[model samples]
Target chain A: MATSADHAAPAILNEVNPPELPRAVLVENNRSFTWITDKICGIIEGKTPAWWWVCFIVACFVASFTVAGITYLVATGVGVWGHANPVNWAWDIVNFVFWIGIGHAGTLISAILCLLRQKWRTSINRAAEAMTIFAVVCAGIFPVFHVGRVWFAWYLFPIPNSNYVWQNFRSPLEWDVFAVSTYGTVSVLFWYVGLIPDLATLRDRFMAAGNKLRATIYGFFAMGWRGSNRHWSNYEMAYLILAGISTPLVLSVHTIVSFDFAVSLIPGWHTTIFPPYFVAGAIFSGFGMVLTLMLPLRAIYKLEDLITQYHIDCMCKITLATGTMVGYAYAMEFFIAWYGANPYEGFAFINRAFGPYAWAYWTMITCNVITPQFFWFKKVRQNTALVWILSIFVNVGMWFERFVIIVTSLARDFLPSSWGYYSPSIVEIFTFFGTFGVFSVLFLLFIRFLPIMPMAELKAVTPQADVHGGENHH
Target chain B: MAAQPHGLIATFETAPEVYHAAEKVRDAGYKFWDCITPFPIHGLDKAMGVKRSNVPKFSLTGGIIGFCTGMSMIWFMNAFDYPLVVGGKPYFSPMFAFPVSYELTILFCAFATIGGMFFLNRLPMHYHPVLKHDTIHRGMDDQFFIVIETRDPKFDAARTRALLEKAGGKDIKELEA
Candidate 1:
């Protein structure tokens, strides 16, 4: 338990381009390496708090709603949803898109940030990546169940079957199946690979503490990792390649998701701008979610030093940048509709903002557009309370954005006979709400059983880790 | 009877100590040696004379197979195996096949990358003489360690220990894994 100050030997001055520019210490308080390990591992090894029990219990209860809703849907059929002739997509599609969009932020932090060399991502990437996996899990439920029969959802894959029915390669829905599944699988590999070093540390700690059961479990996964440099040589390359592939993969996933609409004939959904717009919106909402989840956990764990306000500021700025892009996309959509002179298309955009679903459209505009603008002010970004509340708005707005796009177009299709207002059935509402519970339950378990932060990765960022760094090289 | 003396291990307090120690070991002509640390110390690979990993080769091979699989799978199914038409379009078009191919490429590439890493690292080894060292866990924590194996041609108990001591390594110990 030696303090960092024990060997202070004047802080190592990092070499910079301008020679002596200052940078924020990624880990605050000059915390020692042992402190970092003890702090992170403490969460899992320490007694499970009462509040965790309450939260876990509630999450399970909430998750049951999904289980119940799916069971009923299977028994009664897809008719249990409020989907009708024209608005067949309805909340199922909306909720699916919503959950999928949330998954992007995790990959963005892990892959995109790693590629960009954003060092601060180390503190939050583990949790964000976990969120990505669980969000995808929640997202997978909607489309699978919406296919009218959950059992036949396997049909989405290109596996051989008795009927020899192949998926329609031409259909965007088919592309979505490939894109999402690939995204989910790669994300798990990336997440698990990142966990190995930290897992080995936990295994060693458990063994030292005489917790053979936990140690054996963690050790099996650690794969006899002794932190050997030879192993690290390959491990680092694998990580870099994963990040490289994932960067393109994350962008492609949402673009393909957007293709589900853009490739369609629906006026609002069919836009050349959907790809970049959807990607931007996904990043925007994803950062909002990262903020939402991190703020609470940071507070609860007292991880202020690791998370730091600098990280918060950086996150807020990205949200602002992406949020602005989304707003621009919204405006451009209208401009394209007007400028193109397609009456149906023009009518669709006009109907979206001024039609029956105007409430949802306006709500989206306020939450997605106006909410992020607050981040422009340093006051807002720095205020944890304000940032948390606004992060919720960002997610709410993104959900509505999907809903507005789906519902408004279908609610007033080309024929008046087919036109009808869309609303969710109680089952649909609960099913969508239940996903949050499902996500929370998985996330809670992850925190309880695993290292929520990448300890080894974080240690790498500290100045002390630099061999040529600091005055005390010895 | 003495557990066959697997190798000599030495502890260093910091990355710099290990980095320099690795250089000394490399210069001293040890081949079956490695530096174990809590994390990858930047530039330690160069110090240890380690080359870039060959994981990308496996990743590329997997990607190529995946792409061919996606392309041929669709061509065989829609164009050859079943032979049906839906949207009055050609039976096979790479334009439409690109997404699935691209996804499969990434999927298989990832699988290969992870699999290659594990295969190359000889992981899940479960037992190693190094793990027998009571204080070896420290290598996965804050401390840095250099272990020159008994298998190394240059390995000699007295000489290796002296070389490590000269490189600023402390608490040098000889143990069998």
Candidate 2:
């Protein structure tokens, strides 16, 4: 072995001629980890005027007001918002299912995509995982808060109680408790485990004493990793196993969540196809949110090189695939309703398209189905501006998708005598805003504290990190 | 940053250098040193004669424990403790237990694997004999170096230095705490 002082030029270093890096890119100006890390920290803080702090500040305000609205709703009751005679659980259920469904894309990106050996996942998996956690937290708030007796929420879970009332295992709501809790727990674990190595890198590089401390803490959780072959072997295996676990979870969680609506005897709501349809829709919306979040951050952070057009292109493909599936599901549901020869089901389908919420129905079709077709074009998919706009449309479309499923089906149920129109009150609107606030605040905090990209995973795939030769996708 | 005399410490610029040097060192009848590299160099483990890990055995045991635990827990929860007729369904139906049981099997297997790995590797203590070695920190980046334990039978400070020098060691130093 060569001694430290007598070292040969490393293969990675020798491959590239010392390209003249821009002076403005402080990280490029230095080769040492110490210098590069300090620059990263500087970029994170307002030390450099390069950041769009104005947008972040405005986002913070929007998030805070959302919190205020939530507090107001919680202080009052569900009655403060919506929920009349027939449409008692409209926006709340829709939002709950919608957010939960959106969360699936994160775990799917991080775990399932990783298992499938999709290298592009490394670019956005961290952010997606963070989104998953935040989205679950958002999803959880609605269910608990919607119950009104938020304090007695534990009744959902089975416990040894004085009242011999055994929680019904047959109930889909009970299954939801198990599924959502498990999803949240495992996703958090997966996210944190994935973060360990990146945190250590951040710790080793940054000058901040707090960062150093955090890095140390993260290092401890990182299991004193030295990138040993022994460690990597097990770590890679564990990641594989986690991804395997999460793939089914991504499928099962939303299926069970959809069962919450489907288990009911309601006309349009109760359908055999709801499980698969909802799962597809969830992944679609979740990917849309991922793209929405990634595009802005990639621009703001100047991480275009790291995030690349390739990642957006891949994510757009998934969005299109899922969008088509959802559209197919829409057509299938209507066909099934017509074919079933059930009058109530047929009428429910008819009402959804031509009834009071027809605008919402058309919006869903346009945003989720019609607009996403543009993504099939390579040029349109590569265009960040177009992708961002499409992502926003997908989100709105999916929300209306949930709204149509929940409110439209319930408003005119089995009998026309009990049919009624449901509209969200100011409180419901405020509470919805508040949930966004909570989600945004959590996401902001996550970005500031954690590496938005999995540095270690990226390093594994980067050309410099490879020991055994493979073709570089870049 | 100065080498303390006991045996030779050499740092290679790249992984290939370390591999080449390992073959040379083995041929030269030096068997006392350890190689440190930024990332895994294939075949190094065989060259180093490190034993096969026992983590799998521990993981297998953990998995068995998990499988039984999952079955028993469900049996206890649904069958023994609270035997309520759910949906005209039979109590302790194994089919319904698939999801939770599947989850537990994975959870336990993972726990056991990690736990066994840690126990076998002697990790999380932040103290190691190798930390005292010079150039060890550089192993995280683009360097590949080996520290021959001076206490080994074939180790002689001077002889080791001569052999390493002849083997194209870039920077040879006697590392000490």
Candidate 3:
């Protein structure tokens, strides 16, 4: 009954108007669906490698420094860490800012990139988010201990007490308390929501392998995810909403962090540019840390096909872009200091460049500005060893930047007599250095027990996962 | 009816197979059914006739409550109760209260979104009949499944099996309750 004309298909237009450009495959080597699941889940299922033991032991040894430092300081007073008359806020503030800045890259990757539909983020978001949480843990110690009376740190929250004095809601420090706690809480939720499906996969794997205890443990956390389309319809919406809110949250966290300095009347710190500059530098330093951590991981896991050269290139490009923005901020800060004609501000900028702290300033400039420029070249980004080394420089540079900004401004203030050099004692140095151990210990435990990359997300990006068989995707 | 086999579950090897099968089943006028997949497949919601989630409404409501809480708490503390001015500024201004309110908005919104997702999905269910299939673990890995509940008026043992098999489903079987 059908007409012959209806059965005959129209002649295809062979003349292509717009040329199709090739995009790099997010997951290389044409990995199968099961391969992705097995690869990520295998990390937890397999025996802990020897290097993990070595790293754990070394981390524990280093972590002892923080324990010892805190113990000595608490037994004595905060005075043991070299907080004298002029420089009450020295290494503690610097280390706090540095670690917080390092936390930014993780949220930016997981939230901002996810919103932008950058599929390469799928391979790295899990580890990056974990890094964000751990870095926040490291950053928190400094502020709590810096309060001097660690027991009274609970006063930071808005709780009714006998003192009858409410917190100053107008204060930037109060804003910081709200911002940081919210950032931490929301990040944990986002990370946990993302982990549910992957955890279910782990639970099923363990159930199949006859590992009852592991299955039960994983199943408890998975919250009974059955991969139902009915559930996924809601689950995917939750993930999207989290990503939506998180983009603004990530930006606001750094802005509030910058407010800690900018709200103060300090000459170098009181710039309108601080918010954007700090956010950019945070992302730059964060990517640096990510590269530093992940390069070694990529090699150890042989995840070249999963991670791929394209992901590295994308990260390098973002580092380059953010680094340039930071450099522009530096130039603008100098320009404004001179252009504003404020003697105090001019002197602060001049002192930072040529005064006693010139060495630290130059170290920051060299590491932050010059180091990221190398990523502009194809050869540099492609060379993993070089990229990893540059990432270390980025970390060092960002740290020195915080040190320079804090010390140079406070060390050489308005009064000549009050201006004195501040150097951290051995106790301060050890406590700051010990944070790396805490971060590593937590991170190592994470990679050992949980899926390091998002298996469910990675499967979604592959060609075969496409319901249409992804014929045109190539 | 309660003790009878819970449903017939049809398993498929790939996304496309299951996706097409979902369309066929939906067109067949089955009311109580669902698709199971390792990860969310694009447009599968449309194939299965599922409505979009209403979690955003919960998030918006939560944000409004959080913002109001932040505004009132600051106003009561700084402006009404034991007002002590610091920095010579106004006793309470929305200008300064903005940051805390913004943070609360995000926090409450996130909590509501996640909580609503769980509530809507009826998660933490711990057990379901579809879970007891011999190779059901594959549903959380590479395999896909379409479950037709026995509660549906249109469900018949032989008819559902014939339809699933015709629709390219493999390993079609009834799930134990």
Candidate 4:
């Protein structure tokens, strides 16, 4: 039997120029197998950080405004939102699209990256998936109340009822109910299925420390996972199938959401480019949100070894790519509008860039198009503070993109008399801020209670944990 | 069958060593044996002589049902129940039905996969004999283990321990049922 050293010498010598494998480290500083579990599980087991409590409390306080705003809106009616004759789909719809777009990154990381065999996603996928679930929740809240009678939201589903009034199958609104709900349900199951092994790890850790209650709680979720080969076989297969299912589902979700506008006869809204354009924008905003959350998290948790520079760099590249795609879509929308020679469509394009809401149009251009181009330089991508700040710019820019799309198109339609400037009421502004609070509270609790990083998955990617090969001494 | 007093547990430092031992145990004709590890060690199923999972088949079945349901619901609601033309398009257009059908297919498939996993694993069985073993905790950490049940036909305690030790297993123990 040839020793590994003996085999390595010939392979190294045989190649004319062995491609220099990209020097990026997946897990930095050669972390040990036990170190992976300890560092990750330690976050859950160890004392709560003071900053976490501060963030959580602040998030909850801000989230209270959402409750108050919703209460007032329900009491006073949708008229409180500044929705008038033409600009009726202001702030609420824009926020809905923005949040739903934010969720795409999570599914993109977990399902799409998993299928593509991108090992780096293992570090961030769990948290990203959790973010998807919470973001969808925030997104779902808007359209439900946008109907004015929130209680009658159940009518959105195609249930057999005594009223005998069936939902329009051709309506994009009906498709949205299915798309958003299905996306939410699948995201949760994927997150939980991935969490089971790590939950078992937590169960054992808590049990060892004589914390019976915590053990019981974790154990219940773990579903008595004994790591049997039989169970693992099914688990892996199920995970793969889910990844397969979710990849297209994620794309479809945003596409269906896009159809809510694109299917309409409105000049700016009706375009063939909306699906790909929306999907790219969704990924762009999603990565921005990931960067916003992860940069601070990596600093706070001191998880530089696990969530390394390479992960951040890869994410930056993705943001750049998706941002470029979004920019292309923006350009294409204008180009097609002009080339098609339709006066309403051509006017819509001109109005967007130079009309009443031109400020928002330019903001979207600066933040989404211009800011991310800075990432083409390695220096900008590697700079954590710059990346984090730029991510916030992308977030703001994406919100504006939706704003420009919804309000500008509606504010000035076919009839000149209905044309009016629209601005969000205080209630609408508060509700939007409140969603940020809702997302933060869920995220803070998630980081505190659950294994934020998938401990088992992180371990699987390390050299020492490889099953086929012997441990790499390096 | 009555609960056994003890079953043999063998611990290995690495996944490959335990995987080999699992293969050895399977080749030795042990029926009631299983391996445990911190994570799912790749190719462990082949080593344990386990068959491929049928979860995908169940998912497909679910997807077919969902497709049928989606098509039927849309057609019945729009065309048959009470047709109301808004855009002068066909009431039961397949193109219009595609989105709802796609969503339902994914929804049903996801539910089926999860359900199949749970059913196959006989899960939510909170109490297991292996859970009681002291060294079982390490299975969730860094250690790899193979346990042969007392209920197995070839379960002579002394011989089973000797076989495990020969296969490079460490810290072999008699776990109480």
**Taking the tens digit of each residue's C-alpha lDDT, what string does model 2 give over A1-474?**
557645676677667767766312111222343322333344444443424456466667776765776677678766776789998888888889889988999998988888887878887898999999999998897888778867778887667677756565556777787788878877887787676555544443432344566556656665665545555455555556667767877788888888888888999988999999999999999999998898988887777766777777789999999999999999999999999999999999999999999999999999989988999899998789989999999999999999999999999998789999999988777767767767877887777766677655554455433334444323
lDDT per residue, candidate 1, A1-474, as tens digits? Answer: 367767564445333324655777799998888989999999999999999999999999999999989989999999999998888898888988898899999999999999999999999999999999999999999999999988888888878999977778888899999999999999999999999999999999999999999999999998888999999999999999999999999999999999999998988888999999999999999999999999999999999999999999999999999999999999999999999999999999999999998999999999999999999999888899999999999999999999998899999968777799888899998898888899999999999999999999999999889888665444
lDDT of 2 at A254: 88
Residues B1-177 of candidate 1: C-alpha lDDT, one tens digit per residue = 556688999999998889988999999888999898999888899999999999999999988999998899888888888877887989999999899899999999999999999999998788887787888778788999999999999988899899999999999998766
- Pick by DockQ: which candidate is best? 3
RMSD of each: 5.4, 7.8, 3.5, 3.0
Look at candidate 3 and tell me the lDDT of residue B11: 86
Candidate 4 residue pairs in clash (backbone atoms < 3 Å): none
Worst 10 residues of 1 chain B by lDDT: B1-10
Error of 2 at A397 (Å): 1.0
Clashes of each: 5, 11, 0, 0
Error of 3 at B21 (Å): 0.6
What is the C-alpha lDDT profile of model 3 across A38-66, one tens digit per residue? 88888899988999999999998898898
Provide DockQ values for all models, in the order shown.
0.81, 0.22, 0.85, 0.78
Q: List candidate 2 stretches off by more than 4 Å.
A: A1-57, A206-223, A468-474, B1-10, B15-75, B85-92, B100-121, B129-177
TM-score of candidate 1 versus the correct structure, residues matched by position:
0.96
Clashing pairs in 3: none
Model 3 clash tally? 0
Kindly indicate the candidate among 3 and 4 with the higher lDDT: 3
Candidate 3 local Cα displacement, residue A419, angstroms:
0.6
